[model samples]
Target chain A: MTRWGMVIDLGRCIGCQACTVACKVENQSPVDAWYAPVVEYEVGRYPDAQMAYLPMLCNHCTDAPCIKACPSGALHRRDDGIVIADEEICIGARACMTACPYGALHLHEGRSGELLGDGTRNTPSILERYAHERHIEGTVSKCTYCAHRIDFGTEHGLTPGIDPEATPACVVTCPTECRVFGDLDDPDSPVSRYVVEHGPTGVLRPDARTGATTAYVGLP
Target chain B: MSAPVSALPQNVFMDRWALEPKTQRVWGVNHAGWFTLMGIGGGVFLLGRIFDITLEAGRVLGLPIVDVVSFVTIAIGGLILIADLGRPLQAWRAFRNVRVSIISWGAWADLVFLTFGGLLMLPDLTFGDSTPFSGLGWDSHATSGIGRVMLVLASIAAVVVMVYAGAVLARPRSIPYWHSVAIPIQFLASSLAMAMATLMLIVVLDGGDVTRSELLATAGLTAVLLVTIVVHLSTRTTAPGKKESIERLTRGSLRGTFLYAAVGAGTVLPIVLGLLALGFDGGAREVLAVLTLPLLVVGGFLLRLDTLRAGIYPPVVSLLEAAQR
Candidate 1:
């Protein structure tokens, strides 16, 4: 019954990519593939220019289209409400990724197809990264909401099995505290309370009707 | 929806239509090419079993070595499939979204089953003696439980392989002509159709006597093709302007293939051959069925080839023009 949600305060946001780097390193995702990306856009005429950055990731829709489209049953929503994928069961089908309107997923490559030898095609320094782990050329991956860490959060003394003390890497790394996470079902939770405080002017891409659990508050 | 000059404009010929000799020749060759490759895989498996046959007891046909054959055949089939795709590197992009795309899901389904099938066939491939003769890959000892577990998993994947090919191509949204849910049914129908046809053709060409089972297979395949056509016609849906587009094939360029190969030789002729044997004894009827199997197989291939060729992408340009109007 507990649906987790996030409240992102755009007013206090800065476009610094610390959150992106944190997510990448924490997830150990390849440099080319980003679990979270900040999309930059410019608005208004040149005389009165303004720039904005929107950090995009899985919206984790209630009626997730990705789940319904997966033929292999690799992607499934867990009892705790997190959508997870069984990599072994996945057939490298990209249907779920395309079904996502928000462009949330990416295919995870397997170790089977990685290049064997150090290359002179790129600088020796650039070759070091490739020497680390052999890339597997055919699997899909995305944010798991740091579920492993969150599940063990109580050991860090924030809360016992209820709310994990270690926030999502992106949220934890945000200097501005722009991203807030908590249970939407709990009226006392910070995210739920923030949404109740802010009005309709707050949400992003509401028309997509994903019933996005994450919210963008106080955006002009 | 003005008629295009490329098409004949009607279903005038009915059952008289046959596959263009060009396509007929090409299809036969194409199918044979694929079958030959599968035979190589099957041959490897048979070799594995023969090595074990002297050591084991009863049946010649049900030897677990068949798993090796099944694995090689499926892998060869997989290769043919990848080669057929217009883009292979971009093929990985198919997995970009599993939730909404049928092709992506189909790709996944095919891979899982294919991998499982390969794993089941592996002990033979490796020629490892740690296992024993049983079911394809099943009779082996469990020196390592992982292989046994994989065999179970592979069996499930084998079924998926059969089902996915049909389901994926039969996608409702992506390919307009392939829209019917009956497509997978058609696909299964066609695999049998082709299998029997090829078997009969090889027997005939090689001047070998045919078996009763092969004849029955032909007859059964003909019935399947007939049922598939009915199912296809009944289950199909068309967009508002698509009727005109579909008309290109129904009455135009594609009409010949659909009418002759798919309907006549593929469906009707095979049915007639089956019926002609109704009054005859098993030997004669069986002979007739074997003779007709190749034609039914041709029809099944036409269904896939013609449908693939005839399917149109949205007449986006025309639609855009109309919208502007």
Candidate 2:
């Protein structure tokens, strides 16, 4: 079975936030929402002051708390260890929001469109074509690891990590190539090879025991 | 041990993905209020059953007042909860995932309680001794049997409702302050205390004598509330996230609420009043009981609010920084 995972190399990340923009455009998330947000923080001080950027997203854990907390089973883990939310089934209870330690899940309140004054836009943007059917007011949403692309890629006999078209928007758009997407189960996969070479990859909130799939290299 | 380094400073060595510490506002006053109201409703029903079993004081104003309170509050609470939902229309989905979701179980429990509690009160509200469905051979004796069954079922459901509120919060691994065994116990104690106070108020208002035993029980439960709070605060966990949450509660921004509302007003004041009621007699005792009841109610609500507010997300930067240091 394929356990989809990601490896983000912090040393290679330039804090450019191009990945964030790509993810937002790909997901067509609300103006306020960013599926992958590059959180920038200052490190060091005085003349040695430097800025660090950390792009945050859903970890898609094996034992996801959001799945357990969802009263309606709106959030569930796929066979391949990808955690996805069924927007239609979500009752907006926000239990998953509290359950997620990563602060990845978000609720849509039907905010005004970026270009329009009445919380809407005259033209249907590119994201509208691939928008989830239940993407309406008062539903919880989160990153799906671009499941549509992955599924389509698999059907077309293309590799997810190696094929540019099959990969996640963030990974494809990352100028510094800091983001890597692949199957953790496959030892020869880029993510696995990267982990083996760089060694001692870090998962966020390991103590949370959610069995996070997203690993980090050169985190600190 | 090396001096504990604070994670608040901007220039800190931490994980690249470390997020700034922020309290989640996913569940606000609506969630807290629903839990508070439901806890009281369920607690009242459970206490009423104890009263029926022991004191045979089930009827108030020629009706089961506790049953009435349960019916009203649970119904209102259920509605409030539904209204709080993003898709209120799809709330029926909450009933599907019963095995894993406490929310599903809670919905089912509330429905059961409401059904039985409503049936129990129907006889009094309707034709009294004369059976409304005599043609169906449903007599007063049969109705009494149904009421008895309702009483048992409602009581069980009531207990579930009380525990469910805390259990839902406890299930989340993120907020360590909430994910504790002590949270449910504290909620249970607070629920019972609030119920007893409400019952005392009702009895006093109805010109009934406030029993010394009831006052003592309230006091005991108040003590339980205090002890549970202390235990919840003091219990050590290996999770540093939990430790940071504890700090936020005891000495951080939420300290005023914890000190004044939850501990002082919610626990201590009620205990003092219960004690005074136990010592005093006649109208003075009744007055004290009345005063104690609202204090407990407000305190209970504040306690829920305090718990909600004190819940701090595990500081990603802090944990990573500590590991590096």
Question: What are the RMSDs of all candidates, in order?
Answer: 13.9, 5.8
Report how closely model 2 matches the true complex, as a DockQ value.
0.35
Model 2 ranges off by over 4 Å: A45-48, A113-134, B1-18, B53-62, B127-149, B237-248, B319-325
Q: What is the Cα-based lDDT of residue A100 in candidate 2?
A: 82
Proportion of native contacts in model 1? 0.06
- Worst ten in a row by lDDT for model 1 chain B: B13-22
> Chain B, candidate 2: TM?
0.85
In the range B198-317, model 1's lDDT, one tens digit per residue, is 444444444454554545555675587578766555443354223433565568787888777777877778767766766565457557756675676567657666654554333211
Off by over 4 Å in 1: A7-19, A38-55, A59-79, A85-103, A110-138, A159-165, A172-180, A194-220, B1-72, B75-161, B168-183, B206-325
Q: Give the TM-score of candidate 1.
A: 0.46
Residue by residue across B131-161, what tens digits does model 2's lDDT show? 4533532221224565566667877888999
Task: Provide the overall lDDT of each model, using Cα atoms, as 2-decimal numbers.
Answer: 0.52, 0.77
